[model samples]
Target: RDCARPQPRREVAAAAGVRAAGVRRAERGELRAVAGFFVEEFFLGRTTDPTDRARCFKSLCADQSRDFSRRYGTSDSAMLIAEDADGELIGCVGVNFGRVPAPDESSADGPFALVANLAVARRGRRRGLAKKLMAAAEAFVREDLEEEEAILLVDQKNVPARRLYERLGYKRRWADPDAKALEVVDGSVVAQPVLNLCMRKNVSGSAGALVENLRWQDVALLAAIVAGVAWRDRLAELADPLSRLLDELVTAIPAP
Candidate 1:
């Protein structure tokens, strides 16, 4: 949706086929695994040159270590991870509750959370880990951090990532006017015309109120009521009591 007028913010899509049960904020012990995943997937996966790869790995390792340390101690920022049933790390993402480092003129001037460094393993691809990670991050932003908006940057050439974000309610509103995309040609570095697209989503609505705020009993009761409607034709006797139970439960829950 880049180069188009702003559209209404969409709800976060439900995750499907994720191997891990859920995503959680990273702990200190998981720092190494998180760093290694980023280096392998984002850095090492990009090049075949041994020297460049080695240097880049070293540099990225230190940078990611410092970044993890910085975000771990802060209450407003977090690095989230998803592990498989075997306890092996499979997906990771980070969110920082603050203003963008350098926002473009066309962007909003208010503070917004930035979602960064989202990565999924090769084996975990096509299994919905990314969506789960994003849902949790946005939940943290709205329910935990109490922020109204979330933004992210993706390379213009990375069509898959861009499409995924769009499906998750983000729109490519603008690009960082001052940012440059660079590539090493034969021997010299040249700047490309494609800028990093800054996509954003508004997360202030009550899209996930029940999932985030309701108790287990409330959810179960609601689910049972919905299911009861399908069987109303066969067993008309149960419909009235189910309706009464739903009414009682709805009255008990406070309005937002």
Candidate 2:
């Protein structure tokens, strides 16, 4: 008997006659590439205090690679990663099989794939690396399971994410009419603070795309908050105005 692990076919985009981003189905255990950079920073500032922050972060980081272990990188699910020519993982997408019971009892629960844990490194932003990862996940659900649609929950406040999915072809579909709220797990001890909007995309034959993970917008908002705090000395003069601006910026940014 002969045995050699199959290498996922790499797809590339050509721009100016040069290969841009490439995407592939990450084999089992490849998720470590994602946990290394994306997960670490994603959880750093979310914890409450200095003493326990690192401890909490460590746990959260490990969860990224382990949460979907049932099908992660195996035949049952897809862990697609987008990398540069240097083989660095810049973006990742997860698609796991499950059932999303219909909004009403009119139809029984059918095979559905849940798209989650999408992340893209800062260096890879605005470069279409995310779209690449999404394409791979959709393909897995469509071709592997012969499913027509994949369902995902997006934070109701995340406009960029909503717009991204809309561009790729997902829409609200909690019922025959209105989308419904879903109380999803937030972390080790609580449910998400805000309602998660239910969205679905048609992928049975040919269709497209979809983390709520800490994003660039969050980093910038954090920076703005730190800067405003630093200006505490000028409270009588510039502090109020600067604080107002920071408030607006914070409101504009969606929570992860």
Best by lDDT: 1
Residues 83-178 of candidate 1 have per-residue lDDT tens digits of: 776566778898885555456466564566888888987767777888989998898888878887788888878899988887777777676656
CA lDDT scores, all candidates in order:
0.73, 0.65
Residue 17, model 2: Cα distance from true site in angstroms:
13
By TM-score, how accurate is candidate 2?
0.60
Worst 10 residues of 1 by lDDT: 8-17
Worst 10 residues of 2 by lDDT: 10-19
Please give, for residues 9-68, the per-residue lDDT of candidate 2 as tens digits.
Answer: 432232211236677777776666666555644444354565565555566556655764
List of clashing residue pairs for candidate 1:
none
Candidate 1 lDDT (Cα, 0 to 1) = 0.73
